[model samples]
Target: MARIVDVNPALVRQRAGAASEFLQVAEERLEFIRAESGESAEAQVAASNAIAAGISAADAICGKALGRRANDGDHRGAVELLDSVKPGGSKLALRLSKLLSDKSQLQYGGYCSAAVARSLAREARKLVEAMNEFGIRS
Candidate 1:
């Protein structure tokens, strides 16, 4: 039988909202790259890398919130734990996310593109700002 569990709706909304926003930003960047560069192999690769970085950040933030909720015995509310967290590791996550993905390849043979770097850098800035607004630091 499925048990009806009481969960904090606010928390759930916050976590989901943050994650969704992160994903949205990544997608926006990808779309822009595609529209501007068409099917150029290098452009496509760069876009992929940038999107991957955004994914990494989103994953890190969601993973941490979920972990915290689990440790606190709030399984039902785990999906909404972002609101309860004070954005502590978000900055590090943002920076690491970009570096771990496409940013590191900015100087590669077919990777050094002004547009790609700009997009990734801009996304990183947006993420940092969002994390800060949520009180995330690191």
Candidate 2:
């Protein structure tokens, strides 16, 4: 089980709202981000936004359906929680995994290549959209 904390069901919309906003920022960054360029600053920014989008989307989904949000330092726990959600949760979990997998490289120091950056953005968008499809988004 993941280290998750209880969240009020009433805050579902708030979390969903944040997810949507983060997704928007990620989308915008992906568009302007010079993926093939040597400038790592833009890649880091885009990747960071993508990571944030995934985290908030996961929070919204978990809170709305399970009344719990991942609170641990390890993100894999959150992935496990999403995988436990019914129906299409497994799919969402896989996509979220891809985004989270790049967190360390993008956030810290590991060389976030263009392909990795693009992949993170793609996964992040898919997760947010899937969360919306699950009827849990605000």
Give Cα distance to truth, residue 118, candidate 1, Å: 3.1
TM-score of each: 0.31, 0.86
Q: Count the backbone clashes (under 3 Å) in each candidate.
A: 5, 0
Off by over 4 Å in 2: 35-39
Report the Cα lDDT for candidate 1. Answer: 0.44
lDDT of 1 at 18: 49
Question: Under the 3 Å rule for N, CA and C atoms, how many clashes does model 2 have?
Answer: 0
Local error of candidate 2 at 133, Å?
Answer: 2.6
Q: Compared with the true structure, what per-residue lDDT tens digits does model 2 show for residues 75-117?
A: 8889988888876889888988888887777767855555666
Candidate 1 per-residue lDDT over residues 12-67, each given as its tens digit: 44544544454455455454554443344545454544444443334335444443
Candidate 2 has its poorest 10 consecutive residues by lDDT at 33-42
